[model samples]
Structure formats: C-alpha cells, structure tokens
Target: MIKNEIKIKSEEGEVFDKKQIALAIRNSTFDDDLRCSLLDDGILDKCQGCNLRYICDGIDQVVDSYVDKTTEVVNNFDFE
Candidate 1:
C-alpha cells in the first residue's frame, strides 16, 4: 500500500482519525466502484451497510464522482 495520509470529515463536521479511516478503507470489502463512491467529495446520499459510513458521509458518492481516478488508483493498488 502507498500509505499516504488522508483526512476525512464526517457530516457532523467531525474529523475522523486518520489511522482508523485507513484501516477501515484497507479492510473494506467494497468493490472499486463502491470504494470510489466512498472517497468522493460529493454528498453520498446512500450508504446503509458500510462500516465507515458514519465518518465517510457517503464516500460512495465521492468515489463515483471520480470514477477514472479511483479506478486508476485502485488498479495500481495505491490505496491497498
């Protein structure tokens, strides 16, 4: 994994712990498409079963919004 640091804020404007978020992302079973959506900056609108949903605030939307980049990063295992 690239192991770069990233910060994500919750809908309540609370910041998620970086290591916690990274662990969640690393262990997530969500597919590339789903993972992408979870990483987007847009409103998620839907995330029922995601463990990180509370802090991610619809990362699925973010991921979906950046389909090309997400796919590339995912394919490269940059976020592994």
Candidate 2:
C-alpha cells in the first residue's frame, strides 16, 4: 500500500475508493469526548465481536494512515 494512504479491500477483492473522505475529514472538527467510530476514522479500540474481526488484518494500518493524513492536512492549515 502507498505511504499515508488508506486502502480497504473487501472480501471479494474490491478496493474501496472515496476521495472526498480526506477533504471531509480535514474540513471537519471532532470532539475529544466523542465516541470512537470504528472503521470510520480509526480503530481506536480492540475488536470485540465484529463480523470479520479475525480475517481482517492490516485494518489498523489503514486507520492509522487515514488519521495521520487527516491530521497532517488539518495541521497545515492556518485559518486566520
């Protein structure tokens, strides 16, 4: 996978592509107290009872990439 890029593949070998996700994430603000939206931004917690918890590996990497990219974009902005 590309560095700092998020690539999620389905069980059928389909890659998920949503470009606007990065822009949306960069433009939005998240509260620290908000619930951790698994597979939305990042897998902040351990998997307890998901449908494909075992088979799905590298998910944490994708989540980290997305979060890192989003944070990078957001930090680079200087809204004055």
Q: Highest lDDT, which number?
A: 1
For model 2, which pairs clash? none
Model 1 C-alpha lDDT per residue in residues 1-80, reported as the tens digit of each score: 55444555678775657675545554453552224455365545556775776656655444445454455543543565
- Candidate no. 2 TM-score: 0.24
Q: Compute each candidate's TM-score over C-alphas.
A: 0.24, 0.24
lDDT of 2 at 20: 41
What would the per-residue lDDT of candidate 2 be over residues 6-26, giving only the tens digit for each residue? 556679775645664444343
lDDT of candidate 1 at residue 37, scale 0 to 100: 55
